[model samples]
Target: MTDVAPARPGPAPRVVLVPGFWLGAWAWDDVAPHLAAAGLDPVALTLPGLEPDHPDRGSVTLEDQVCAIEDALTGGADGVATVLVAHSGAAAAATVALDRHVDEVAHVVWVDTAPASDGFVMNPDVEGPEYPLAVQWDEEMAQGSMRGLTDEQLAAFRQRAVPQPAASLRDRVALTSPRRLDVPSTIVCTAFPAAEYRSYAEQGVPFLAGLLEYRALELVDLPTGHWPMWSEPERLAAVIADRVPRGAR
Candidate 1:
């Protein structure tokens, strides 16, 4: 009998879900079950300062958040890469972490957000130790739409919201690796269409600038609100499941 060749290793069948400011892993509850059903393990993360109850505020820096993400990206079984899913404000820290661990990530799915350019500060208005969610929500709405969220969903969001560390927002991004752009990336445009994001990228928007350099980047239009995990979770889950590396699936 001819000897059989061993199967090549694939990425870990895991997806790390990181939510934006003022939210925790609980924000992904609606979408996690569906991902699990699709044969992907979902590890939802609550960054250092956003944990339930008042954790240390004002003290958690952007580096702290980056470390948290790096921790999640490591220790996969069989030394396989992982898929990272970052939503809203979490994308800033995720971008820096991705830059450092580009080889460890199979793909990055930025939900209604984009990788931040180096030196980008997440929130310029944070003056106190803890930045409240209300103020940030208003500013976010002014910048984009929260179109599909219902009153009940909005109330629940408010109830579950926590104060984000001022330092995390104030700290600037420090990306040194140009190789991170080689990793595959997908931007799921929710509040706005892919066309709009492309337009911004063409016009040289600071936040969208990194998208231009990504060697493998895709933009998917999901058509909901910025917080699609809450408003269109099933569809969002489906979109993410489709991007899981085929071997992992």
Candidate 2:
């Protein structure tokens, strides 16, 4: 009698893509296909309040966002590695998720933003029932950020952009787990150079300071704008595909 062999599992790791403020899963539409081509599974999330016609923006807090990402990580198939990729304002929620699920998450990729420290609020002063998207492109760009976006792309972004929940920005991130600092992390520098970001971390900049705690920190330069998914989707996907592992860690 011939012995039957068990079927081997597919890929070990999957990439979880979390878009920043005013963006939904649609933001990753361009990037996901490329990741798939590179043999990676990309799960792009819209987040809670950012969804079109979502009930109440004010009710969505940072913890709610964190929980959403956490559910994604834990709900995946057993023994599958997971990489959390967060863009812009979503970094805080990603950080909290990494803190809570340190054992399960393999890597954290921060695009144009860094993890926020405990008690940190992204924009506490920007009072919001919901923060409206800025209409002016020039005024919307932050210093070196938001480069490489065309006029048409800008117009499209403005038209589709949703208002960010106030609580998500104003509520503090509460992280008690110190083990989160042990996870490997990569910071994709889009608006700023890697050297400049490292300098900021060295200087004890509040937001960037938490990066110093990471056991394995990699600074990758994407050299685009704040929204690389819109500006350079292929390049963004390539960078992410290269950094994330294919097998369980």
C-alpha-based local distance difference test score of model 2: 0.83
Candidate 1 lDDT for residue 159: 88
lDDT of 2 by residue, 1-249 (tens): 112133236754689999998999999998998777666678999888898899898888888889899999888887777889999889889888888899888788899988878877777897758987877755547445678887787777888899998888888888999888878888999998999998998998877867777778889998988899989998888778766654342
Which sections of candidate 1 miss by over 4 Å? 1-12, 135-144
**TM-score of predicted model 1?**
0.90
Q: Candidate 1 on 87-150: residue-level lDDT in tens?
A: 9889899999999988889999999889888888876877989888763367467345666888
User: What TM-score number comes out for model 2?
Assistant: 0.91
TM-score of each: 0.90, 0.91
Residue 6's lDDT within candidate 1 is 33
What shift in Å separates residue 40 of candidate 2 from its native position after superposition? 1.2
How many residue pairs of model 1 clash at the backbone? 0
Residue 196 in model 2: lDDT: 95
